[model samples]
Target: MFMQNLPSEVLINEVSTRDGFQSEAVFVPTDKKIEMIDRLSLLGLNKIEVTSFVSPKAIPNLRDAEEVMNRITRNPKVTYVALVPNEKGAERALATKADEVNLVMSVSESHNLSNMRMTCAQSLAQFRRICGLMEGSDVRINASLATSFGCPFEGIIAPERVIDVIDQYLEIGIQSISIADTTGMASPRQVYELCSLVRRIYPSVDVTLHLHNTRGMGLTNALAGLSAGINQLDASLGGIGGCPYAPGATGNICTEDLVHMLESIGLNTNVDLMKLLEISRELPAMLEHETSGQVAKAGLRTETRPLSQNVIDLKNRNEKH
Candidate 1:
């Protein structure tokens, strides 16, 4: 059934430059990165994940994180968040005047060990230490639980395991939490059940969903999230950013595609679809790779002369179904 009663407004946090470029082989120049952010801002995005402040040895692509942070023409209305893995990374992010600092640790024990080289308990303790270090800083903390849905090394993650990790972040006084499908192992049922549970547990916390399209279920999972009362979503232009560990994994859901889907369904994202499409068009050339965005490849419906009989029939059949 169509969701006519769904809330009209939803927030889309653009993560193209940071999460999108983390896996890119070539380093996008600081100037180009700034240009991309600037353009994205013009498209009416309310938030943007600028870059991560991790060690240069870990993510060489963002070695110029400071440069990218310093160069962008930041919009006063838009919130720019930087991902900081540890206290040192948080310090680097704070120095850049980032509006928010996002901290994340994997929920699965094996994944946590592999990703952060720390146990779940140890990671929570580290986050508590980082929170203490903030000490009246303007930067807000948003703790993300990566692999909240499922893990590659360890198959299914228990719902209680996710809640246990979230409890730690909340106990440390983190107000915002971003639940990430780091390896894109989430399904619609999983998203609905888990998101509802999280919302129930943390009623006042600002929860955001960072979905991945690796299994072609990104949009479906997003709708499930929306039904579960999640309004904030993290998406990348051209569906960028794939897991380095997960073989055959795809990128995050495409920002333009998500926006298009939402708008088509009468949801307001405040994002200009045409301008977003322009950004997606330039992305492949900027990154020098073929993107998988259908809207980008086929163009928007408005660009066509008119709906052909076959297309109209397909739409009719879809509506009838």
Candidate 2:
């Protein structure tokens, strides 16, 4: 029997444009990026983290945030989200009419400094300021806790610390929260426990899982989160992303593969695998290197396995003999 607690359908929030592109060494042209976002909007992703309004020096790949936002065809069905590092970023995102504003901080103090060059408290202050800037607007606010499971600077994080960050987000009137396995140090048990703990403490808040595949456990951790009654998940097309500041951190979970995995198990992510694969197939050319995703190489779940050529050759030899 299907687990009653498991959500039958989950929302896949594609963060390729923001999270994925931020790490790319090459700056994808503004027009191409906008075109990609437009196509993604129509392809049934529930939300798209479209771009980050960070300083050009910080993430030069996404420097054309305003042009990309202004040019993309907006689909009412898809929520367009932008990452904001501070109140100024929030203001820029609002001016471009982003549907939601996302802010991130690390639970690990050392990680926070390395990644954002700020203490956890200072990051919270920035989030608060962004909240104030976005107040009275229809734009929703979401808080992301990077290094939720483990930190490279520090080892395993206590669950209480994650809760502490959420408490502040809740107090600031941000109901949507994402717990990220930034370094992919999360085990399934830890993920399950964290999701359950957060659910128990703040049942009403929406939780999304943003996980990296640094240790090749992103999908497993996602499953754990789902088993614990969480739904939304963040993914990047072709699994392209990594923290520039955090050493050893790597690309995110592959979008097509994640959807393929969940859907094969009777869960719904509301994403079209074929359409998503079309996007994934282009990543190698787009980035000038092959991607980290496996589905593109392994084919879809519904496809029949390719027959063994050696077996066919052996049968032909026997027939000739």
TM-scores of the models, in the order given: 0.93, 0.93
lDDT agreement with native, every candidate: 0.89, 0.89
Whole-model lDDT, candidate 1?
Answer: 0.89
In model 1, the clashing pairs are none
User: Any idea what lDDT model 2 has?
Assistant: 0.89
Q: What digit string (tens of lDDT, one per residue) describes model 2 on residues 1-321?
A: 334477899899999998898988788999889989998998889899999999998889989999998889999999899998888899999999999988989999999998899998899888888888888899999889999999987999999999998998888788999999987899988999999999899999989999888888888888888989899999999888975666545589889889999998899877888999998899888878778889988888689976699998999999999
Least accurate stretch of 10 residues (summed lDDT) in model 2?
242-251
Model 2, position 155, has a per-residue lDDT of 97
| lDDT tens per residue, model 1, 1-321 | 545335679999999899989889789988889888988877789799999999989999999999888889989989999999898998898789999988989999899999899998888888998898786998888989999999989987888999988887878898899999988899899998899999888889999999999899999999999888889999999998976766556789999899989987879999998998988898878888877677988877557577899999999999999
Q: Which residue pairs in candidate 2 have backbone atoms (N, alpha carbon, C) closer than 3 angstroms, thus clashing?
A: none
